[model samples]
Target: MLTRDEVFAVLQTVPDPEVPVISVVELGVVRDVDITPDGVTVTMTPTYSGCPAMREMEADVKAALLARGVRNVTVRMTLSPAWTTDWIGEEAREKLRRYGIAPPGRADQGGFVTLTRARPAVACPFCGSTDTVLQSEFGSTACKAIHSCRACGSPFDEFKAL
Candidate 1:
């Protein structure tokens, strides 16, 4: 019985386990939300197949929906194609930067391809400098790990590889 806007309002609060600043929508994880007569069925795609945070993310989504008085919730995981940071909208990108994790940077292509977080030139989210490198492939959480910005001489956790 809930409207799509109502659903998205609730979902906005469901933060990404790895990147707190960005919600599942910003990360392009929660692909669809269905308000059916039977119940609510949420379709989602993981950033990657091997993403360890998948279970937690699904649980969080269900819990969040339920908290909004939605019943018969179903969180379905799908990997039809894949996830890309480009799906993360500009507003979400700003939030990511403010969260202190660098946003997507230079790639081999002329930005024609999806913005790739993997092996990207992530600038220092804090200093806004491009001199940054991956400190660790894994981060504090199962979904993200350590990174160091050479320009600002600070270390940060980038979104973990999906």
Candidate 2:
């Protein structure tokens, strides 16, 4: 039987399909790991309710565990608490920056909806400058936005805070 830590170690090897540089664990999606004599269950939360990469992520998690000799593996997803960028650790944030994607800032917890919320200026990942312009509200994915850095004249993606 595999221990919880062992399962997590295996899970850490599974990278997110969208963000290949970071593992699902580093993305803060792997919420819990439960082990039993019969099988292993992994609980996860998607970055959003309708994230397209979630199916791939779940498959990767199960495949990773199965490769480790586990006969049966289960991936359970929960949306009760939802997913937040705040779950992302500082180290993972730095990894995102190194990958040329601006890490998300603190998530807005105002609990009120506004038509137009003032978005903070995101620092450039390449030149480390705050002189960045929002090129588009949508990027390659829904959770990201497109931006251009004035200092480096480079276009990059900014992971939106949720």
Candidate 3:
């Protein structure tokens, strides 16, 4: 029988398919773990409702747990609480920075909508410069934005705040 802690430990080894530098657990995708006599169930919340990586992430979790000798594995996704960038830990943010992707800043929780809001400058992950310009609102994925650093002339992705 696998303890809850042991299950989580195994999940920590399951890296995110999109962000290989960080585990799915580190990305705050795994919401809860339930162990039963019949099987183990993992509850997950996608970074966004339509995130394309959700299926891959669920498959990886199942495969990882199965490889660990678990007989049955179930992945349940919930969208009620909706994933937030604020769920990302400080250590994970540093890892993203080291991986050349600018980590997201605090998410805006203001309920009001504003069309004239100026976009904040994203710091360059490679050169640590605030003199970065947004090359495109969309990056390799919808969850990230493309930015170019004026200081080092490096193009990098910024994990957009949800």
lDDT scores for all predictions? 0.75, 0.91, 0.92
Strongest candidate by lDDT: 3
Give the best candidate by TM-score. Answer: 2
RMSD to truth, every model: 4.0, 1.3, 1.6
TM-score of each: 0.79, 0.96, 0.95
Tell me the tens digit of each residue's lDDT in model 2 across 49-154. Answer: 8999999999999899989899999999999687888888999899999999999998888553232688899999998999999998889998889999999899
lDDT of each residue in 1-162, candidate 3, tens digit only: 699999999999999899999999999999999999999999999998899999999999999999999999999999968788888999999999999999998888954323345778899999899999998887999889899999999999999887
Compare candidates 2 and 3 on lDDT and give the better one.
3
Q: Give the C-alpha lDDT of model 1.
A: 0.75
Better of 1 and 3 by TM-score: 3
Residue 85, candidate 2: C-alpha displacement in angstroms: 0.3
1 or 2, greater by lDDT: 2
Per-residue CA lDDT of candidate 1, range 29-132, in tens?
88888898877988999877888888989999889988888878999888985676557777887887787865554223433333344465666779977687
How many residue-pair clashes does candidate 3 contain?
Answer: 0
